[model samples]
Target: MSPLPGIVGALLVLGGCMVGLRLLQRRYHPHPELVRKLMHLCVGATALSFPLLFHDPQPVWWICGVAIAFMLALKYVSPLRALLGGVLDSVDRFSLGDVYFLAGVAVLFTVSGGGLTFTIPMLVLTFADALAALIGVGYGRLRYPAADGVKSLEGSVAFLTVAFVSAHVPLLLSGATGRAESLVIALLIGILVMLLEAISWQGLDNLFIPLGTFVVLNGHLDRPLELLLFHLAAAVTLTALVLLLRRRLGLEGSALLGAAFVAYLCLTLGGWPWLFAPAALLAGYALLAHRSRLPGDIHALVALTSPGLFWLLLAVYGRRPELYYPFTLSFAAQLACAAALALPADPDGRVRPGPLAARVGLAWALVFVPYAVLLGAGGLVPALHGLCVTAVAALLCLALRRARRLSFELQTTLAATASLFGLAPLGA
Candidate 1:
């Protein structure tokens, strides 16, 4: 298989996409969404053909770089922006979807461990997501705006259905998913993807659907019943928390999901015996949230999402508890700092970065030092990981204050990305 053919195919698709989008823009000036979806469909379809086009990973990288470069070019280049209405004309201040799309594609090519992993993310994105966009607008009714989006129950269910079938079909054909595996794991992945999609706004689904689907598929729940029960319990309890706190705290549905998922993942990975620290700590925070009147800001989000993400990654990938708990404790300390920073300081309600750092240092000393001492050297990497997360989250909040609004959800989510270990692994 000559690589030249695949490379040529990719180039042609890229050129055609630019030209086609221009044609569409001239013809359908008012239909920005149509133009956008068309772009999504074309790019996704092109990504789907990668395996057929390139026998090796090198060309995939070349294609990815070229595509990303082109997207970036579109952003800065005036004529190109005019031609495509700047990547689908979403309300987001920036084209996050373009970055997400390319990242998802690159992730699939680089990280997929063959078999089901290679195909599932691509299939759902290429087919299920595209289908959902079309079906959601056409057939959707009984809309819920805040919890999900302008999405209706019918459309959400439609996405789940297609996602589930898309997941099962390729694996079934390739003999990667057996009957039992398909019954539970595949179904769960589909449902999870749908839940994420429901919460997704501004085509963030381009990122979450593919990457999240990949993670869930890779987690490989061996004792499905146990995790299922745990997930259910956590989801229910956290949702109840959302109901209780939403009006007062201004928490979003995604925040509720963050609480729920970490509750499950934390307890599951740590097992029944290891639930004490998180349980006690969170309960204490609940009180602080009440008495302190914590603002539902991005700082609070960073507080929750840290533990949530670390627990999730730790459970999924951290096979050994000895080494990971230190990292977990470090994040715990950071969470405490995040919680404190969520409140106003001194007589004034303003938060200063200097005092915030001092408080964070104190919190880390109070929590991480003791926990790390208890755990010994096993906690080193986890502690470093946790410290770095807190530092970066704080710095980013400080740095981008003028540019981006520091919402709780985005802050917490940014912290959570740290927990994902940068899409690598939990390591030394």
Candidate 2:
């Protein structure tokens, strides 16, 4: 019952599994992916026993820490790599999945104290993720681009189905949530995490799926049926709209789905006002930029929206109203920068300042005017101040582009800077 025994036993089990996997690989010569999935299931299932074995989280943390350290050593240490290569290292893809798996276990245990929240995510990560991989490889025919590679739609659907069942059956059996609410919550989690996994690059899904499921499941545990239904509707509608207009929006595959999920969070977390800025920016970009000029990848979308996302979280969860202005300003700045860069250039491959200024002005107005109108007379000062700062940021970004050829990094930096300066008028 004590943590010390559980910790020792868990460590031993981990060690045994590794050695057994190595021996099995040597004798049977199973596929590398099959070996990796075996490791995933064995380790994750062992971790599931933590709540039963130890009363405190410290022991679980110790096991996870030790496992992570040993796995790291196994990857790099020549003798260990040679010994374990057929197990984890033989897979051809670049993945930090093994490390992320251990880290997710530690994080989930700490956050949920090894309750249903922890159990559900672990279940999804272990069973659903592994099944999806096997099914995708075996049955996948419809493929689309993910982060750096392609994934099958069949695999995504399998993940969604398994995740929904994994989340629903537990809540339904526990009787903590009503059947209908459980269904909604599970469906929502399935959809969101499926999208996350689809877009993830380099095994980041190992980390994102569990945490993202935790956030969704934890947030919706006791909500009313109507609210849960609304969330479900919102998610479905957003996904549909993104898919319908994917080409026009300059988004496809993982990028399209990622954008939809991101927008859904903004709407759900901070309501319509928060959603307005991104909506306007998206619409403005779709209208103004040529199809060739629009961003169609997750990396570019993150660069564009992360600044506003940062401010949105601060405003909503941190209960900082002033941060709302910064959130809107962040989007405005990004829109301005996007507009400036997207305009047509002269024969010399240079954009005239007049057209660039006009484009930026149009984008700024498209995004900010509605915001100003919504804020009424009192918000006029902050809106105008944000406008000025956004212009300066756009101009500065252009100068950098002219000098060094503009990069997503500069665009992100300017967006964040403009949002920070958006605080000045609030102070005044």
Candidate 3:
């Protein structure tokens, strides 16, 4: 009838599930997977039903708070660990799956206040990912390696297919007769979510998949065709790069896919003139990998850092030339320099500073030369500022190469980010 009663009822439901899990642990002992999935199903179902059942967010927030607290207690307090028994036996010792699960639900619950943003992504995770797990475990034959372990190609296909259908079918049926935009958004979101899961370190896909889906819906739903074309370009670039990488190393399919995705985003999303750097880096690495005969692995720090800067730019300034220019240009220079330093010179992963400068110079010329012509001499100061900042970042990366807390990856990320701020004045 009121918020108080609704809170009570929701808590009771949560407590009931906990007690049920505890009883299952005692009775079944080793059937922890069943208990785990049962909890997952109940949690998701409860969250999805919240906005429908209650009229306000107070009860929903309160329930999520309790769930979060319970998960934290289970993790830190020794006795609570017995609740899940062995369902998490295969997970890493430091795995945050439980916490992330509750967090995902809480986030989606809040997003549900706005409508389909929550409903579609939750269904995709609860239905698609789960189906993929079931199918992959029993029938999956063609497999690839992951941070957690090997996953089946068939299983991933299942995930993508289910996610696609769950995410888009409602749009088509929801009286959007003249507009195909929603379908495009669904495809972009589904593929991105699927790839993000494939490369998710440890088990963090729980967080990324849900959150990423929300971003696509919130940011690009109105511009579905543009988003679709952007992602398609990403797919095309990623595919072409994979073919080139094949001639060099026996890299995993996911790695190739992620690289392509990153390459395309870096090259396509920002300013047209600024993209040449990512393209050059992609070409250089593809060639180097082939020539050097070394195995290629997509480092998370590098992969995340490259795209992350782009996201930061978009989030902060979108496509505004004045602000976006400095950030994008500095990012390009940082990566170009880093690529020079990090490029495969030999089998030992050593840097050839002389060659590094040459490569960086070439990449810079390809990017800024065209930029300067288009914008006239006005682009000169910003271009110089960007180069100086990147050179400085290159040195920082070298100095911090052995820092225990700041890995080369972390240093580059920080340096690249800082360069944007440092050079923003020039663009402004």
Best by TM-score: 2
Candidate 3 ranges beyond 4 A from true positions: 18-35, 83-93, 112-114, 176-179, 224-255, 263-274, 287-320, 328-357, 373-376, 384-407, 410-428
What are the runs in model 1 whose C-alpha is more than 4 Å off? 85-87, 90-93, 133-156, 198-204, 221-250, 273-288, 291-299, 311-320, 323-428
> What are the runs in model 2 whose C-alpha is more than 4 Å off?
347-350
Residue pairs in collision within model 2: none
Candidates' TM-scores? Answer: 0.67, 0.95, 0.78
lDDT by residue (tens digit), candidate 3, 1-428? 67777677777887788787677667767344445656666766666676667766667777778877877776667776665434443333456665676677677667657367777777776777677766777688998876656778888888888888987886677644225676676676677778777766555777777787787666665664765676656655665766576655455756666665565555545545445545544454444323433234546524434544554456446545455455445445545545554555455444677876776665566555655676688877766666666566655565455343445456556655754564356434
Question: Each model's RMSD to truth, in Å?
Answer: 8.0, 1.8, 4.5
Tens-place lDDT per residue, model 2, 149-218, is: 8888999999999999999999999897999999999999999999889888888898998999999999
Residue-by-residue lDDT tens digits, candidate 1, 304-423:
546545554664575655434544443454355455545464443356766667655554444455455655786565556666665666566444443456665555555555545522
Candidate 1 root-mean-square deviation in Å: 8.0
Local lDDT at 342 for model 2: 77
lDDT, residue 388, model 2: 87
